[model samples]
Target: MLLATLAGCSLWNSGSSKPLPADLGANVAVLGVRQAWTARIGNVGTLPLDVHVAGNVVTLASADGVVAAVDARTGGDLWRATLAEPLSAGVGSDGKSAAVVLRSNALVLLESGKERWRQPLAAQVFTPPLVAGGRVFVLSADRSVAAYDGATGRKLWNQQRPGEALVLRQAGVLLAVGDTLVVGFSGRMVGLNPDNGSVRWEAPLGSSRGTNDVERLVELVGRTSRVADSICARAFQAAVGCVNVARGSTTWTQPASGAEGVHGDGDAIFGSESNGAVVAWRRSDGSRLWTTDRLKHRKLTAPLLLGRSVVVGDDTGLVHLLSRADGSPLNRVTTDGSGIAAAPVVAADTLVVVTRNGGIYGFRPD
Candidate 1:
């Protein structure tokens, strides 16, 4: 049976004997695991899709351009919006507003899945739209990135970059290092001015093949703070150099392994590589904090930090939770199919997972 919580009031299952995080407040005194609700909004796609939630409403975008918003707690439908073209992964929110990128590089804002506004980009976008710094940043296929007023669908500025061929999406996600918008593309690291779309700095990261720039960034080294500046993106490369946010030079290269999903916190670096290690390093000196080769496999998912826990999902459809301090496994959970498509989101004691099959499941600590 799926264990939800300990006894009737604790965050752990007493019989299973799992340790409870000290921060669990008295609010979520989960008893046993119960199905809050599950709604099959769309048919499973070949590639795992994700479920994006805001407040109580969750939005699901299908491969066929079907979008639906569902109640997070009740699994009830709020609204649905259909699209003509397939959508890229760059759909996100800025708390008050949620933005989506259509296949044709048009950004549409959704509130409970109802269309609010639409803005056209230079070309098709590969990354998710990020609402940050009072603007929504969308990266286009023609090596362009621009921002628009979060409320209005007006273009702010767009800058072009040297890029790879367009057959595949670019790798890397946009990383906001302090004030710089950082991303990996066309075998390089690009840091742009999110305010005006100016090229602040550039770098060459290695081996990124795709339209998904966020994933290219994941393939590169990760900075804990630089990533949180905006939302996170997927993997690709660390091909080029970025103007160090503090150094103002393009010479400082992030010499690291596989340009997977790596972000930083300005102080600590976090992410994993295909080499099968979830690693962290010091931002100032590039000193290693910890590296766990627990799941040494051909491929691995991006690693993220949950509180002090280092969480990594592997291709085998299992997510391993480790202590960020030592890279030791703390807890582990397995999904029915492929490990996890999108990175997992946490809601209190529950670990929210959106699988490739469009199944959103919540796992409580045992």
Candidate 2:
């Protein structure tokens, strides 16, 4: 899908992008080789904290206050929008539309390149607005979740309440399960009504104590032949669970090493445990079928499952391809030596991810 934005050149500035250079000996992402196209974007003195890609359009925001829409295939420039206020992470669509956090304490929509609408925020608007049902759903830093009319940008209904004790700086996804709007925060989960900002439910997530266990697990697993080849040594043996969005009930809980990346498709809920444990549970009973212990990085960028494998990026800049069936190794690739900050997205069967180094890579298994 081709997206057209405001074509004026006055509203944007360009910045330089630090090059990945090249790593000749790396098994993957051999620097300097197989370069599709590289372009330098300048305008903000800060890095874009958020990235999103869909159909032929990929959108992201920079701290320097510029929003960029680039061609997914060729890295061609599509449109750019610079707001006076600081920008937030890219969210709202499955990757089609983008939303930013504004300095005025509001969340605004940036589509193609046009200003869709600007809605008032209660306190610090942190979570990326959820764009669906002709409205945008945003969870403010203060705990109130509001939904605004998508087309006319009118306030529908907002319910206010105290927010969590703290919101995690690490990024998490939002879900609109029926009328329950859920935001996964650090150590807790809050659910709000999408049409009206009312508390539907809240679930408490546990605290992660040790951050260095990842390296230890990797070393321990490496010493054990079967465990080393199957599970990364830095395996997480922490609590992992999901809460209900309607009544704030702690529906089910299990020990996980890290926050599992969660996905709620209509029929099933999908995500991975901190130690690379993958499970697909029936939405009705949360029962599981097959499992795998292949993912090893400690970061929380959720896994994106494709055909026979689940694709994940880690803190070491290595992209591991593990089989989705029982969690066996398929292949791994390296596009950059820098670690990945965001989760990988599925473009058909091809996987795409933007690294912390400010470069985007699209890959397919041979």
lDDT of 2 by residue, 194-260 (tens): 7666665556545445554222221000000011111011112334444544346655554444443
Write one digit per residue (lDDT tens) for candidate 1, span 107-163. Answer: 888765667788766576555666777687776555577778866778888777655
Q: Candidate 2, 124: how far from true, in Å?
A: 2.5
The list of candidate 2 runs beyond 4 A from truth reads 1-56, 71-74, 94-97, 119-122, 152-154, 178-180, 184-191, 199-238, 242-251, 263-300
The ten-residue window of minimal lDDT in model 2 covers: 219-228
Q: What is the TM-score of each candidate against the true structure?
A: 0.69, 0.65
TM-score of 1: 0.69
What number of backbone clashes does candidate 1 have, counting pairs of residues 3 or more apart or in separate chains? 60
Name the best candidate (by lDDT). 1
In angstroms, give how far residue 51 of model 1 lies from its true place: 6.7
TM-score of predicted model 2?
0.65
User: All models: lDDT?
Assistant: 0.54, 0.52
